[model samples]
Target: MTTGQMARAAEAPYYYVPPHSIYPIRGSLSMLATLLGAALWVNDFTVGPYLCIAGIISMLVTLYGWFGDAIGESEGGLNSKRIDVSYRWSMTWFIFSEVMFFSAFFGALWYTREVSTPWLSTLDSQTLLWPGFAGTWPNLGPAGTIAPFKTVSPFWLPTINTALLLSSAAAVTVAHHALRAANRSRTIFWLGLGILLGFAFVACQAYEYHEAYTELNLRFTSGAFGALFFMLTGFHGFHVIIGATVLSVIWWRVVRGDFTATHHFGFEGAAWYWHFVDVVWLGLYVFVYWM
Candidate 1:
């Protein structure tokens, strides 16, 4: 065994389990508060936004503490091979759940476009309910209901974001390889570049939203197209933000010598999430933008 492995085996138990903690309940309560606040916010309650922000803050704090403790345990050699395997499985299932979540939105878009919209066009009630109401993919409702809004074209901004995400994925892959090779400097360089590219993608997306609102008049209420447009892209952007945050944390850990060549599950987990985000963005770019 290598010196690092020998040291870890000597210091760590065969299978270590942590003591009872409050993180689960705290996280659950925070999520409940956030959901309640969202319900109220949608209903136009005055205190809704404040409560939502507070809940988000509480959730962030809970996550910080929980992950911090986990990091400490790993650094202190409390995490054994068994714990590492469990963590890998946990991350795998987490990414699978995310895939299912995105799949739901994609399914919604498909149903609306191919089945419901076309079916509505052929329905006899369309002529009775509203004369000359063409059931198009981006129908503006019965005349004056939805304002006319231009759809976002896949031009400079979204295309740029796609390139950025793709490049970041490549960079991170290189970083992972470098880490395996024990090239800390190269890993840091490439990983940092990847993280920056991710943030750049987010920035580009924010600007795209700004343009959609101000210039194109495309919004959540413009039409079904508008609503689905924002829902898919916005949620994907949120995932990008989350993936970037996780990668940033991993980058910090790498800088501090928190990972070794053979036992870097944390870094691997973060990379997996980043790759998932990249793949989701590609799907969004194709379906939402091109289609």
Candidate 2:
């Protein structure tokens, strides 16, 4: 072969090195806009909502481009086994960090219910400090500072959502198995079903939120109970949306023949994330809802 042809046929490097990209900077700026806009919006600023929407759009665009680049690299055989191992470790740590994130919120909920509220109500100075205060799991604060609000029950909607998420988990697992078996059609079908189930879960949650705000009169300002309730569930809902989006992208890639049975770390990574989300939802169902 000619020298030029030989050069062209050279194997990829042992470790793929990606060039510098502006995706990170763009992502950071997008998050900044989102957080700042949300803060201002909560404080009743007029322009906050628009800025928040803009930020979300910007972030989505950035992620699209970033993932596109990664997909290109993988498809072009730039990623070696070493690179794949690195990706796995990175995802592992990312999931671990998410575990800690949820732990903090769950710990707060536990502390409020088991320790803080009970201790405050039991204090000898309570009579002088705040009369007519009752130590309750869903306290409306002393002297009724917060309006009366009912806590959500886990009977119908939450239960239904739980089932939907569980089914989605199962569907994704089936899809993974199909991919391993090199059954592309079955994989696509199951993945699509999983994405649908995810959307259904989100829809159910949205309806639940509407019921809380409209019928039950519960809101973010409804004392500690409301605060913790929204914090936990809202964050979980955000994660569900994110997980669904990730799965949708993976589904698209699968459709484009981006993965093979033996080499689909992208698919595996997304599946791992989806499973993590499912497990977290189970925890929420037990502690946040049923409890």
lDDT of each: 0.89, 0.89
My TM-score estimates for the predictions, one after another, are 0.94, 0.93
Report how far residue 190 has shifted in candidate 2, in Å. Answer: 0.9
lDDT per residue as tens, model 1, 1-291: 346753785466678879999999999999998999989999999999988988999999999999999988877767777788789999999999999999999999999889877776765856757666687767787665999888888898989999999999999999999999999999999999999999999999999999999999999998788988999999999999999999999999899888878768889999999999999998988998888
Which regions of candidate 2 are displaced past 4 Å?
Answer: 1-13
Candidate 2 to truth, TM: 0.93
lDDT for 231 (candidate 2)? 93
Off by over 4 Å in 1: 1-13
The alpha-carbon deviation from the true structure for residue 269 of candidate 1, after best TM-score superposition, in angstroms, is 0.5
Per TM-score, the best of the predicted structures is 1
